[model samples]
Target: MSKITRIKGFADYFPPESEAFTFMENAARDVFSRYGYRELRTPVLEKTELFARSIGEETDVVKKEMYTFPDRKDRSLTLRPEATAGVMRSYIESGLATREPYSKLFTFGPMFRYERPQKGRMRQFHQINAECLGLTEPAVDAEVVAMLWQFLSSIRIPNLSLEINTLGCRECRPAYNEALKAYLDSVPEDGWCEDCLRRKSTNPLRVLDCKVPGCKALVDDAPALVDSVCEECSDHFGQVLAHLDAIEIPYTVNKRLVRGLDYYNRTTFEVTSGEIGSQSAVAGGGRYDGLIRDLGGPDQPGIGFACGMERLLLLLPEEEAPRPDAYLAILDEAGMARGFLILQAMRARGVIAEMSPTPKSVKAMMRQANRLRSRFCLLMGPDEIARDVVQVKNLDSGDQNDFSVTSESDLDALADFLR
Candidate 1:
């Protein structure tokens, strides 16, 4: 038998890393709230059709990356590859679409994708996703993007760049696909991967998302959707740009931008960082005009974005989240018992408390607490318990204070001594 380790492409965040991620999540949640977006939580697993219908069958996510499996009942289910589809499922199921014209919603949780292990990409990752349920206006799209920018700024993430574009509405999408396919067809099929060849038949635009060396060269001179956008799409995209400009949100027109999901209809954009490799996209979103009707809801337009927590952390300064300032050290069986009691009492009074299950020794616990950089050590022993007292030592000042132990009473004297 072999000792178990984490599967490739999956990661376990240790304490310090987990702390920093929590900070990032809290800031994202707070900023989402300020923008009038309330939270929505859904299950990590959903019916397989949810994603198969929402994310295009031709896309990488649906074709290869999704973690799908079966249950005891033999019904197929999948660990969500992303949030939008599941969120949409919740919206439709709850009948929230009929009550509100625009229901702003946000969700954060783990999303699973079965991709090869690599930098930036992972098998399991966390996303802070936000969705705007019913606004058809391009201003709504810009506002979401603005909120995303503000969130990154709030956390001091450096070198953020916004790449915006329009992928055309369903009414006019066929023509653009025709043109894109015409361009794709001009290139020899032998020069591309098998998936790209299949994409040529079902989803030609995904070839643009490919990093294949041969396909890259083939599409280098291909026609862009921006040049092919229909009149209504052109107007919609212009208004989105105008709204972004009016709000003074800096962005660049990336005519080549296209989302892997089939749901994106217009005004697609991705916020990227220069330093991160392969996973350069920190956040991305777009309009899904026909999605409501597609999901059997009344015709509702929507827009939103999802940010990767791990990738966002990469953009921040190297300084980690704040660690605990004090560790209450306990030694010996009697001292361990006393420490547990003290921890309960101190925690009730709003102190971050830590204690080992079994007391090692006074000197050992002191060293452990000091390595943790605890501000002070609360030392107790059989002798101290006998006198109904414990020693409070300030590691920094090398000063010690003694206090009687009791179930009720202010430890003001000990507090004053430490100070």
Candidate 2:
């Protein structure tokens, strides 16, 4: 009777799209490791309180966007809205303080936040998070930002602009909040979002995250967090800027740019690009120097950032993605079995090859190969098997050759051709 349908704000990453995700993951992993960061993985399902405490109770993620449910033991659990909390939970629980100042750690996986589906934001999203714990120097901030820039360059995502801000330390924020709230409270009541109205009381800083034009215009004269940074924080922010300039990476200080999390403190930054509109935020992260100890660790200082994989994938240029070099097509029933064996051989030998299990007409298979844009197609038919060889066709140039299938030596030739 009723047609089955997927839920709102959920999506599947098909094979073609997976290419970009994988490239981004690999690029991030390489960069983090090069910086001496290790990998730390935590469960996708975390205690509900972890995020509630870290992101803040009034934040959208905790107030309305988290995907939380009862576990088998009736304990509250949540599909992680973000990965940093899980990492914090692990560091404290696993006694990582013993490895104090753990540098350059990374995790790449899915993140869930049940918010309105927009251009870049998603209910079920993915992130390539790189965290460097136990470091608070502004130089650390520069390194983290540099790594992000290098990652985007590696993936050929263009036009990345950097916007950074200092949320100030605990001391500076209170005064700034008072000023910001005063400005917002002065605005006509009709201009603010219902959520902003709530924030005006609970977490006044988030009023800036609102998209309402009238609300934004009203806060235009609001106190800037950067200008209000305490002397020490101002120095740290200045040092981070100096490091960026020393390394030739340009940035702009946007005082109103508060990362939508309560734990984020000092040196917050975002990378944006035109390729992914409206959701153009390709990456963002900041120093959460206090989160480790707050989560239960022994007062360890750390700073790190996490980049959104889905957003980066959306922004990546087409030719930059890594794609399969070959699609092996089997033309008849007998060829299907042999084709699978060849597929195994190609993969074992490091060939970027693909395959279709079912046999199809030569015309249909050829069309499929072309549609996939495979550089080469290896076609094996009963006729070729009798000759104890396979037909290797280069789709790029329409060149054809025959090779014996009896040895690894023969497959090496195919692999080389695909290369």
Candidate 3:
């Protein structure tokens, strides 16, 4: 017999840890809804070609990290490595464009990537995704970034720093790519890492994102993308910054922050927190003005961000699980029958009540109630049943009172008494 264990890169949230996940989901729902974003859910698996087409075959996610395989019918399906692609697919498949001009949406669930597992990074991870579609205004870009900041603040996440960058649109990115390529070609081959060497020819922009210290040193003085952006891109980037300033959102413009996706163009931003170790970015997103059309959807502008849940969980303060209002203890068969009816009636009245499942000693039931941190224990014994009342004991205060349980009026009085 072998002992069962969880897979290395997956997580099993338990007890207080699960509580933290709930807190994040609830908080995200509240904040997203307040900003007029409705919740959307899509399938965990998608067509493999979707990634190769939208995320780019040259990128790391499609080329090296996606969890892709052929199903029984000989069609390729993949566990989603990221979310935006799937959302676009759904929008197109559902004919949402004919129905609505734009959609403000948010979704959160598991995402898979076959990368090495590290602290705050996982092969199977979770993300809180928010997107605003059909709008290309620079002000929307600023609003999306501000919404992300507000969410982090609402969760009590600490020490966050905002990094913003502009990846020139189709009109200007080609020249910047050529300039970047020229610089990479001028550098000695010895300084480049194996990944950078490949990306140099395939996707020259990715060379700037390499983490190898030697590779980074070689690209240190490469031409900044911001400098190569055309007039429209420059003006849009400037307005994004101005809007951030108008709202008092502090930021640093990072010239080297080319996000790890091929779909992004103009206005890329990341929010990093000091608490999450070297995997510092808790949230990131950018404008993908061309992706909806690229993915066979209506041509519309979209901007969004995703927060890493495991990383955010690391920084969230421990939250106490809520306690039940009352526990019903049944002492004998006669009392059990009466208590069952009372339990349902109490619940119908919106009282959070539970009963001992089986016949147990009064002392054992009391202990169980205490373990659950219930506020009160309703004791139903032979004497209490004959008297048509219950012994209500306040577990915290150790005070006891007799409450009538004979009729609906009595139950209403009991409910009022408890309140």
Candidate 4:
């Protein structure tokens, strides 16, 4: 028989690691809720066209990274590679825009993408996503950034930096696109990767986002989008920066920081930390005013961000193992019945308690108690039960004492002793 193993790019979180993830998630939820955002959940699968439509047909997410398949009845579906598209689809289908003027929503769960697994990336990844739909105010963008900043700070991630950029809207991006395309045409194709060559004719702006060194160097002299944005876009971006400044959020404007998505426009930002090596982008998002309308919804504007849980987990401080309040060790059949009663009573009092799964010698039980790091151990044997008493050992201080009880009925007395 062959041994079973986990699939590649997927992770298993055990004990203290799982506890650390829970702590981060709770912190995120607390921060998000404080700003009047409600939790929203959507299915992991959506129609194949949803991503293709929202994340640009030419982007890598749709071209090569999506996990798509045809379900029964010949309908094509894809496991969600990101949450923003699905959340927008739900907003449109649920007619949420009509019911409310603004929607502040958040969700956290698994997202699937078929990409070469690296140190902080996986086929199965999780994100804490926050979105504000039906609002076009620049202040909303600043608020989103502030909430995420507070969340990372609360979790104690070190050496943080925020990068901000603006991809001018459809109204002004064409001029920059033409200038960028001409520059791409001048560069010899021999130095470019196959993807960059294809993008030069297709979505040429994406060529700026390629990570290949030769490809990156070729675009070093390419045109900047900030210089090409129209007055309206420039003002909008200026207001976003102004708001960040008012709140004392430090940021650097990187001309080449194009996020790996097609829906972004006018204002894009990323939060990065040096702790994660190379892949330092811990959270990223921008305003997507056209995404709602493109997905067959109204012309509602939206702004949001998604933080990778796996990446943030890499920066979290190690957590200490939790200690149990008491361990019950029973010797002899008569003491077993009384042990059950005391265990229940201790638990009812909000004390963490456990018993050995099987009967064992005193030495073995003590070893188990030590391993559990239980504060105290309650021992019941034939002689102790006959005397209507139980021996309690303080595992931490190495102190021993005998406490009297009325056989199996003195739960109050046992609870008082443990407390």
Candidate 5:
């Protein structure tokens, strides 16, 4: 028989890394809630059409990366490659907008994509997403970006910078697309990457987002979408920048910062870190005014962002695991019985308490307690049990005291002392 191993590109998180995951999640909940956002959990699996219709069918995510399969009844299902599509599906199906026109929702969970794995990129990764629905105002865009900025800052992700761009609304985008496509066509085909070659005819905007060195160099002199937007889009983006400025959020207007999503329009933004190499973007999003209606719901506007947890984790400083408040060491059967009761009492009183499950020599138990990094150690043995008391040792100060365990009141006093 062979031992089973984890699938490639899937990872197992342990102590410190898992703790960091929790820390980031708690920070997201805290900062997002301050901005009137509530949690919304959607399933990881959805109809394949949900993504194909929401995220553009020509996009790389749909063309190459999705983990799609068929169920017993032959209906296609896909493990979500990103969160926004599922969120939109849920919003439309649940009539969320009818209930609360201005709904701000956040969610944190795993997303699956079948792509080449690299540092900070995995097949099964996690994301922290927030969506602001039912508003089309530029100020709302600014506010959503600000909230995302605050959440990342609160978690202390290092070397952060903000870059923003506008993809232009449907009315003005076609012109820019044609202009960009003409520029791409003039460039010799030999210089473009395979994907860019296909994209030039399919979706020209994605060429600017191409990371290939040759493709990037070719698009260097390409027309800027920001320079081509209509008056309304220009005004909308200007206001978004103004609001960010009013709130003291610094940003750079990168004309080439078109995010890799088809639904975005008007105001798109991304936050990158210098600490992470090449794939530096830790978070990005923008206004998607047409997604709600596209997903078969009433026409509503939305803006949101998603932070890649794996990428953000790369920027997080090393953290230590939490220490236990107390560890109970029992030296004999009698001590084991009493220590178990005391452990329960201490836990009931909110102390982070743990006890040895079986009898062990005092030295062995004490070593186990030390390994746990407990702040204090409670020792009980035949002698101590006979006296109806437990010896409490402050692991930090090397001080010892005896607490009675003969009565319920004694147990209360013992717990109080531990607290």
Candidate 6:
């Protein structure tokens, strides 16, 4: 028989790496909660139409990356490639906007995308997502960006910077798109990548986001969308920048910072770090005032962002696995029975205690305890069990002490001392 292995692009997390993930999650909950953002968990699978509508059918995510398929009943379903669409679907289906005019939500979970795996990109990746719904004010955009900045800062990700741009709203975007399309059409087809060439017709703005060197160079002299935004969009963006300044959040206005999503409009922002190689963007998002309405929900406005958990992990320092506080060594049959009771007592009192299932020589048990990096080594034998006591060695300081276990109160005292 052959040994089974995990599917390619699907990663298995273990200690240290897993611990770093948890630390990032806990930091998200802490920072987001401070800004009145509550958690909302949605299923990883959803009707394929949800994404096709919310993320735009022409986007690369829908056209090439989604893990989409039909089920037994022949219904199209997809492993979500991103989170905002699902969150919007939930907000509409649950009618959450009706109850709370302003809904701030956050979620952390695995997201699937059928793309080539890289240092910080994977087929099955995780994201820490946040959404602020109902308010359309420029201040809302600024607040969302600020909250994201603070969360990333709290985790101490080094060498981070913020880049923001405005992709004019519907009323003004058509004119800029025409201008951008004209510029793209004039450029020789040989200068653009295949995707850029297709986008020149399907979605011209996406050409600015292409990572291909030829495409990037071609867009160097292209019309700047920010320069052509209508007064309303220009003012909205101005206010967003003003608010960010008021809060002391530094940002650079990147004319080409069009995020890889269709739902975004107006304010778009990204947080990047030099530490994560070519995939430098650790987090990004923007304002989507029309997403809710497009998803068959109320005319609610939303601003949110998502952190690629894998990318953020690349910036985090390696973490150590947790260690047991105490390891119990039972030297004989009698010690095994009494040692089990003591272990239970110690655990009941909130001590991180562990014991072997069966008895072993003291030398072997002590070696095991040292291997676990336990702070204390507890020893029990027939003599100690008969005397109603156990010896505890402080592994760190090389000190030893005996604690009486003749009564429950004594056990509590022993637990207190160990703790």
Among all candidates shown, the one with the greatest lDDT: 6
lDDT of each: 0.83, 0.83, 0.91, 0.90, 0.91, 0.92
TM-score of each: 0.90, 0.87, 0.95, 0.94, 0.98, 0.98
lDDT of 6 by residue, 80-180 (tens): 99999999999999989889879999999999998888888889999999999999999899989989999999998999999999999999999999999
- Candidate 4 C-alpha error for residue 110, in Å: 1.0
- What is the TM-score (0 to 1) of candidate 4? 0.94
**Count of clashes in candidate 1:** 0
lDDT of 2 by residue, 1-419 (tens): 99988888888778668867777787777877888878777799989989888888878779898899998899999999999999888878878768654656789888998778877677888888888877778998999999888888888888889999999877777888888788778888887778888989898988887777777787888888888889999999999999999999988888779888899888999999977666678889998888877777777776777787777767776753465788887877877777888888888888888888888888888898888778888887788978867787888778898978888788888777677
- Full-model lDDT, candidate 4: 0.90
Across 1-419, the per-residue lDDT of candidate 3 in tens digits comes to 99999998999989788888888999999988888999999999999999898999999999999999999999999999999999989888988778887889999999999999988889999999998999999999999999999999999999999999999999899989999999999998878999999999999999998878898888879999998999999999999999999999999999999889899999999999988667799999999999989988788999999999999988998777878888999898877888999888888787888888887898999999999999899998889989989999999899999999888998887776555
Q: Name the weakest run of 10 consecutive residues (lDDT summed) in model 1.
A: 410-419
Model 5 bad stretches (over 4 Å): 407-409
Q: What is the lDDT of candidate 2?
A: 0.83
lDDT of 2 at 401: 89
Clashes of 6: 0
* Evaluation by TM-score, superior candidate among 2 and 3: 3
Candidate 3 to truth, TM? 0.95
- Using lDDT as the yardstick, the better of models 1 and 3 is 3
Predicted candidate 2, C-alpha RMSD: 3.2
What's model 2's lDDT at 316? Answer: 73
| lDDT (tens digit, per residue) of candidate 4 on 1-419 | 99999999888989787888789889988988999999999999999999999998989899998999998889999999999999999999999999999999999899998888998899999999999998877888888899989999999988999999989998898888999999999999899999999999988989998989899999889889988899998988899899999999999999988878889998899999998778999999999999999999999999999999989988988767879989999986667877787678679877789998666899999999999889899898888878877789999888999887765446666676677
In model 3, where do residues sit more than 4 Å from their true spots?
416-419
TM-score of model 6 relative to the true fold?
A: 0.98
Q: What TM-score does model 5 achieve against the real structure? A: 0.98
